[model samples]
Target: MLVPNDHVDQTGSQASAVRDADAVVRRCRERCDQTVAANEVTEAHWVARITAIAKDEDKSAFAEVFRHFAPRVKAFLIKSGADESLAEECMQDVMATLWQKAHMYDAARASVATWIFTIARNRKIDLIRKNARPEPEDLPWGPEEQPDQADVLALQQDSARLTDAIRQLPEKQRRLIERAYFGDLTHSEIAAETGLPLGTIKSRIRLALERLRHSMS
Candidate 1:
């Protein structure tokens, strides 16, 4: 039976449309798969870097983490209302904790960023409490908890990493981190002194930390 010409033309157009749609679907699937694979590779790279530091006492590996995390940790402290100098002190303590406690890190449980940030958050609170204490003359003399040998060693290791990492930051971010660490002014006080909005200060600090994490990693 001879098909009508219009019928044949319509059938061909429908088939062509179907093929075009299929092609688009295949390309999208391929792109999605590639993206997933790339993400997995990046995750593994960070996990391996941190694991090396834990198992080998690898300064290079620790440097990688420090370069990425220390500045950001300082930024977080500043955001949480620490003075720059106190924040810096707390940031250093937090990094030392990371080095010493690297062995405790489990990629299965948390990402490196999460672990470091938690330490920073806790240390910031501790510093506030410590500073709130009355002067020596106001309080009775009593024994304080002595730092352990391992902590001392970990802090010693952090000196080099901290120095190098700070240099690698952008000038503004570096200064922000330093001020957050060393400036006597509290975050609110600093805002008042500098005449900058509190939200702007926090946002800049947050962005700096995120950039540091991405680039250093």
Candidate 2:
């Protein structure tokens, strides 16, 4: 028995749809494979650079790492609440540590970026804590007095305004700000947690910070 013309057309359309979907799947798989291979090559290249510095005291390799990572490390420090000057100083220290302790790197344990950023983070914290310590000249010579009530009231008002400003932020910006500040997560960590691109996470956080500063000001 012959099938109806409309039924034959419908069956052919279904087969075409299947073929199109299969092609799409193949393309996606190929792209994913390419991306994975590219990432592996990049990781190996960085590992080799660090190894060269460790084994041969390679200035060129160190330069390559510094040139690439200095800006990223500084940006990370700034995002973690350091001022520009402090970030610059900490970034320099981080690069110096990388050079002096290249032998300490373990490719099996962490990626080059992770190692470098970890150093930067620690250095930033150290510098901040050091600066926070009161100098001998800054110490009070007498018994401490109570804080002025007017000053306390002003501080509370400022805090309340800041809280209100944060609440007024767009949901996306507020969430990012909370994650970056209150949640104490780095941009890279936030990107990993949210499945966002690193650049995107940075952009959102930067925009959110600008908004907060403007609101506070």
The candidate that achieves the highest lDDT relative to the unseen native structure: 2
Candidate 2 residues 55-135, lDDT tens each? 679898888888989998888777777789987987888899999877766443345776786677567666757654332
Candidate 2 least-lDDT 10 residues: 138-147
Q: Record all residue pairs in model 2 with backbone atoms less than 3 Å apart, i.e. clashing.
A: none
TM-score of each: 0.43, 0.49
Best by TM-score: 2
Q: How much lDDT does candidate 1 score? A: 0.52
Flag clash pairs in model 1.
Answer: 84-179, 84-180, 84-181, 84-182, 85-181, 85-182, 85-183, 88-181
The positional error of residue 17 in candidate 1, measured at the CA in angstroms, is 44
lDDT of 1 at 39: 37
Instruction: Write candidate 1's Cα lDDT for 3-116 as tens digits.
Output: 222322234433443344334434444433444333333433455566567667888877877787889888877777778998788888888998887766544334466567
Residue ranges of candidate 1 with Cα displaced over 4 Å: 1-40, 130-217
- Measure candidate 2: CA RMSD: 23.5
